[model samples]
Target: MAIIRDRDLIKDWNDIPIDLIKSCIQEHQKSIPRLDLLENYYMGKHAILSRSMGSDTGLPNNKLIANHAKYITDIAVGYVAGDPVKYDGKQVDEILEVYKQGDIVSHDAELAKDLSIFGVGRELYFTTSNDSPIPKATAIDPRQIFLVVDDTVEYKSLFGVHYYPKRDLSNAVIGYSVNVYTEKYVIKYNVKDLNGQGYDVADRIPHYFDGVPVVEFWNNEEQQGDFEQQISLIDAYNLLMSDRLNDKEQLVDAILMLKGGISIGDDEEEAGRTIRMLKKYKVLELPADGDASWLIKNLNEADVEVLRNAIREDIHQFAMVPNLTDENFAANASGVAMKYKLLGLEQLAKNKERYFVQGLRERLKLFANVLRVKGRAVDVSDVTITMTRNLPANDLETAQMISTLSGSVSTETLITQLSFVDDPAKEMERLNAEKDVDMKRQQKAFGMPINQDVTVDAE
Candidate 1:
């Protein structure tokens, strides 16, 4: 046997071909001898011993001898026939040493033969526990490594899995060593120290690395006032004037008598000037003024009500006579009609009732002419016809007759008759008396009224 160095043994373990290791174990039945023995020998011991041990004095010598032979054969095959190897502490140390040196460890035949006894591996790599006194080297790729030095900080091992930390790379400063996994880096100074040193820590921080300042800069040297004082004074004056005009009482007074143009007096000229001012500002306007009407029209209902209440109050207190005349009435009606026209009422016009009645009468006359042309007598008794045609009949019978014939009567005659009877009861009494006297005269002349009952002798 040759004495193999630890490094050489590790190299062989790293260099062995995986296929050769498998073939050697299969042919010799030598690899994993202990595992094979465990599988074959003890597996059937219980069944064999159970029957033999039931004898009077326990198992016979022959049966015991046979069991012993089987156990011996298994042990010899496992230990001698199998080319087994032991991977003790020394071998493991050697492998780790090689890893620490950053050298490539390849599998070879010798190490594979040794490991085949236990059926382990052809090649393996090792590392020291993190707390062990092992000199660590930089990973082959530095980008894969994370270096942290803070005592208070903590880290978790992901069981050899790699993870990259998110970072604002654009904001990173030059000459800083960043932990690629943790996204943290050591700073030359803390925030307080940076401020004490008059160095803007914002300049070094990842969030504020860009050189642009956050606050805007103004150049005082080139700036001018540009008459801002005068502008401010004017603004103050306008604000005060607005406040004064906002007073409800002042606004109403300014709208009313402040512009007295219809009176005569030395003060009239001043009043006229005031009126001009009010008109210019549109605080007051002439009657039927388009602009004034527009203002009122645009006002909300509440505001209109407020102004109307104010006007009513003024009229009540001052006892001013409202100038209501035919001209004014006509103007008001025209305004109302104009509003109605705008609201889509096409028939809205001056003297609306007259226009409506005339139109109705024309329709009735056309209906009556149509009935007459069709040879129907004008039955004036139908109230339905009288109402529909706007025909007036003296009585219900006449109204019914008018409806039967679909005829119309003159409205003038009906209206005159309706007015003739000042007292209805007196008119009814006089008419009944006249009717009785006429009936008597007819009875005396013809010996009876038409269709009156009479008796005669047949013989």
Candidate 2:
């Protein structure tokens, strides 16, 4: 199934065929399971299964991989979009107060985390309550929403389809929508509510809207997770890792290697009893000319360790995530040194920042429309979205540098670079407060009146 190249619909999304939308949504359904698997891996819900040979012996140990794929995703996204976007649009500040009122920061972080795992994230804008001052933006799981695009001209996504399940008065309704340019066409049908227990038909037709209220985000144009390709490497590592553990277990509870003719039992029950007795007593009685020797083989621990490390390193390399466990990240590593170690991650973070900032701008544009309808049109185009990495930083070293570069850069530069300062304006206020307190203390120490006002330069 493919999206028909409707060049005519480029400017008018409403001209797109309804059948095309339905076909795309249906075709995309098959990919949902694959997305779910990736999500499950990120959630640490591995599918390793242990097998049991017979009921007592030869146990098949299936251990999950280190799940570093999820680890890589968390660290990358945490360092990239971990911090909230610092709003620089003076006019959009009041417009975004509604977001703070809705706790959009936490929600946006979660969405970014998911985007790291799936390479796709989205936010649906709508009013949550009657008194909602700002429209609420909801983070949507990619699996729940399939983006229909003309594979060739999806760069702008001027026309597309999306389907998701929503709860209605009686049951979960499968809803589909086609977004053209800025308008949205929606249709919904009732289905079993996941559990297949209840059913309700939400009577809704193909409703039309003036705009697509959702803003889609992607890690990049390719929309593939960092560790997605290394999944096979992860599996290889898990297999080898599990083998080493299994070897140790077997050595502790080794198999019985019997030799020569030894008849100690006449029936199955007797045979079982004799086998247990041999193991318990660690002894075996045989004929006068019979002989036996215990058999045990050592596992190649060094070989397994080497293979495990190699696979782990490859996973880290492919994911562009630093192995924090690496001994190279020793004690007292400077912020610059850590950044060097995580150079690839920092670059990835930069790319993510660029892509995410575009989505944020679009969201602002959509919100701007809402605000305009309310007679408060805020041009968020001037707003600069700053993505600060939540990486480890040595505040002392950073302060020293700031002091060294005093007057060279703006004071705002020093405040913004400080890892602890999420908002420069607020940090400035806090610094002033601390400085005032220190000045009062110093005045008392000098036997001066506490009421004396002295400008204490904290520089």
- Predicted candidate 1 versus true structure: per-residue lDDT over 1-459, tens digit per residue: 001122222233222232332232233333234334332332333223233324574322222212222332232222221321111232233333433354321222222222222222111112235564222222211122212112222221111111123335686433322111111111221122211232222222221111111111111112111111122232233333333333432334332232323432369788688757866886544444233222111224466456544543332222111212325323544445634422321111112222223322322232233234444323322211111111122465544554555435543233224423333345656767898788778878977645556555588
For all predictions, the C-alpha RMSD in Å is: 55.9, 6.2
**What is the lDDT of every predicted structure here?**
0.29, 0.69
Against the true structure, what is each candidate's TM-score?
0.14, 0.79
Residue 233, model 2: lDDT of 88
Model 2, CA-based lDDT:
0.69
Q: After superposition, how far is residue 329 of candidate 1 from its true place, in Å?
A: 16
